[model samples]
Target: MHLVTGGAGFIGSHLVDALVESGQKVRVLDNFSSGREEFLSHHEDSGRVEIFRADLLDMNAVKKSMQGVEMVHHLAANPDIRLGTEVTDTDLKQGTLATYNVLEAMRMEGVSRISFSSSSAIYGEAEQMPTPETYGPVMPISLYGASKLGSEALITAWAGTFGAEAWIHRFANIV
Candidate 1:
């Protein structure tokens, strides 16, 4: 079975659709803070998808949801950079701590692979227009970016020590 952390959000909901179509068993963990119930409502009747309405901050809940899952797709995060200024700890709790919970849960469950949704914000005010993965010394300008970078570091360490694998994708604004 596959686990999608933010499986009720825009990107996550779409990913669920594709996974279901491909005949894969999917389980989702979301707090509905930014995600919507309607996104998964259509699949409610389907037995292939299981929904767990919980926050990533809850370690026990996260661990419970990760049970029997093989691969994980972690997308739960506060994407709004503006909110970071007002709620200083929001980025840390949602982005960093939440990711930590997921990683720990996966480790305990003996799951191996993970695909993380990083961001171009980690690069901050880079001189390079089209930044590549090999970009030097990532300097994040906002708390959100810092949280993502922190999560990346944690994942890297986990992969090296636990013999796990991950694919980190840093997305740039298309428009």
Candidate 2:
């Protein structure tokens, strides 16, 4: 089974739809903080999609949800940059800690592959207008960016140590 965390949000909901259309069994783990239930309502009748209302910050809940899952698409996060500043721990809890829980869960479950939705914010104030992947010293000015970078590091370590494969995607502002 394929697990899509934050599968009720905009990007995640669309990803779930595409996965469902491809005849894959999908499970969703979402807290609904930024995600809406209405987004997955259409798939309620499909039987191919299973929904679990849970926060990624809860490691036990994330571990429970990972049972029998072969792959994970981790999308759950505090997407608002402004909120990260006001709520100091928002990015840490949602981005870094949540990612740690997911990786640990995957390790315990023996799941081997993971796809993460990271951001270009990790590049921070780039000396180059359009920073290339080979750019040096990625200094992130925002809490959100730092959190993403932390998650990426954890994922890389998990992949190397636990024999898992990870695809870390650094996305630019598409929306």
lDDT of 2 by residue, 75-104 (tens): 999989889889999999999999999999
10 residues in a row with least lDDT, candidate 1: 166-175
lDDT score at residue 136, model 1, on the 0-100 scale: 78
Clashes of each: 0, 0
Instruction: Tell me the whole-model lDDT of each prediction, alpha carbons only.
Output: 0.92, 0.93
lDDT of 1 by residue, 1-175 (tens): 9999999998899999999999999999999998999999999889999999999999999999988998999989996888999999999999999999999999999998999988899999998878888997899999999999999999999899999999888877523
Which ranges of candidate 2 are over 4 A from the true structure?
none
Clashing pairs in 1: none
